[model samples]
Target: MKRQLVLVALTICAVLPVAQAQKVGETVATPFQGFAHSAKGSQLRDQVNDLVALVRAKRLSDAERKAIELQEKFEASFDRKMRQYSFQSKEEYLEFKQSAPEQFEWIDWGYKETLQMKAFIAADKREFPTALSILATIEKIAPASAGTAAERGYILNQLGQPENALAAYKKALSLSTRYQSQRPFQAAALRGIGFALIELSKLDEAEAVFNDSLKIEPANKVALNELAYIRDLRAKR
Candidate 1:
């Protein structure tokens, strides 16, 4: 029962924006906006934007179906284009500097955001494997991204892998400190860690982790409610 409660809290914390049905078939705005300066970037961004709109505005099954097809085609298009430039290896992508510098720069900036949006769609659909795959690709592209690590941890937790979730959260925290501007993200990572500890029945450790998270943001309702729930459970014991 306690574990179920913890799961509920985690789910609420991870709740993503779901577009209303009335908004279906509409192109939605995202953080990855204005990425259409170049012809190639514009085309790819338009397609991805459409996919994102479908994912958020329609039902989950329909959204997932479309997202899967779009992802396949999107990857294939990139693969075909890179092959034309002899960029066979992912590592050899930097060679684009010689062939298509503009494309190189555009992809370097856009792919990360594109992959992140795809990962968000997968997570929204509760497709853990797809979400993790997208996140792993992002990790390779941007290794120092604490946000990616924290999101990976959230997916792992949703899949009931608390041990792995805890490890991912720890990595996020370590990386967060190195990127000072990510302190707020670090607090979220801390809250995730606390939830993982709770799942593992490490109550004392969980309490400390939640308290530390609350210290980072006093009005953190997630941490505050968790603290109260922990106390209630302990008192009942």
Candidate 2:
């Protein structure tokens, strides 16, 4: 039992999902790839990188302040842009959206990606409540965001709220249906679900969820480890 618990702890550490800013060595791969092509978006990306640098330098308060400022600026810019256009009907709005998808991508980047950084900063500081509040705001603004839902699940799991985490992960899976190509997000959500189930002492269910996660991400070390742990657990039973 002690060994099983240790495995669970290791699994949690391995799968703690944190939304990170684009690091220097990493490539920017997101659904909003086009947003990076725009001048304003590129500027915002730079600001986010600066925030990341502050965090890396152990300037948590400064990073948090910068994150808040960035969020506010993004909100103001988004509102100003929206006020510049007026649509006569829903059809017209849909037409505009189809024609100018980048506009929506920018909005999504502001609400999802930017806010995610804020939440990550708070979480890194061990300010879990503040992190959760930021995530809640993201959910309110972008209800269909699978990433946000999965993030919430990870946070809630850390808070020892497995039931809520399970719900959040399941919601992420449901929201991810529209983003069929985003298998990594789906696998992450499934892994969160499995972790939550393990916390609930539902070993069999957790094993099943981990298997499903592995099906999505064949190279998922976390799921593979958890599956081995679960099998060991059952063997001792």
Candidate 3:
């Protein structure tokens, strides 16, 4: 039960806007909103209904051009939203180059964390390759790319590819000695390895990895929750 709750928390924390439309709360103002939509908008509703059917079918027969076009639209939306944080955040980002030199070099402050959150959602949705692709782009730019590698491995484990996931986790571990000095991302890598081990069903190993992560980030809620769940599961067994 604890583990289930942990997963539920993770699901909520990791997931982005799973609902079809981007905006939520206040009002969509976009006519058709899920099942609550009006039957009067049948013409508009038909397209949504078709999308639902296609999603249920687990495949899209869209042509290559359409696929690319949709991907671009999604990417544009994601980028646009990433920059739409609080005014304070926008100001901080603008001043990133002048202040906080170490972190500023890393493609804006919250960029990596945002991508990590997005990847987590993708992993929960079983969109492994797409998640990896995002991580890969990050890897190409960040020197501390090993953390993303570990995350990718966890996603692989969730996809039932434990061997590959383990390999990726090991690669992340190997990065420890490679870094010239202690880096912030090392903590993230450790946490990722812990998550990968959990998904791989290596409980003992996962606990050790979580301990390592805690050594770096004692206040990490996800790691703390995960470790608690693992302890609960072990006690149950």
- Candidate number of the best lDDT: 2
Residue-wise lDDT of candidate 3 within 177-205, one digit each (tens)? 34422133455566666776777678899
**lDDT, candidate 3, at 149:** 66
Better of 1 and 2 by TM-score: 2
Listed per model in order, the count of residue pairs whose N, CA or C atoms clash below 3 Å is 0, 0, 0
User: Would you estimate the TM-scores of all the predictions?
Assistant: 0.61, 0.67, 0.44
| Candidate 3 stretches greater than 4 Å from native | 2-126, 137-144, 180-182
Instruction: Please give, for residues 1-237, the per-residue lDDT of candidate 2 as tens digits.
Output: 232211221122123222342221123345334433442334465576566566556676886798788877666655454322222123323455676635543342333555766777677667889878988887765554566778778878888899999998889788666443222467778888998898898998998888987787788777877787778778888
**Which stretches of model 2 miss by more than 4 angstroms?**
1-43, 49-62, 78-108
Highest TM-score against the true fold, candidate: 2
In the predicted model 3, the residue pairs found to clash are none
Q: Provide the overall lDDT of each model, using Cα atoms, as 2-decimal numbers.
A: 0.59, 0.61, 0.48
* TM accuracy, model 3: 0.44
lDDT of 3: 0.48
* Root-mean-square deviation per candidate: 8.1, 7.2, 12.7
Clashing pairs for predicted structure model 1, backbone only: none
What is the alpha-carbon lDDT of model 2 when measured against the actual structure? 0.61
> Where's the lowest-lDDT run of ten residues in candidate 1?
17-26
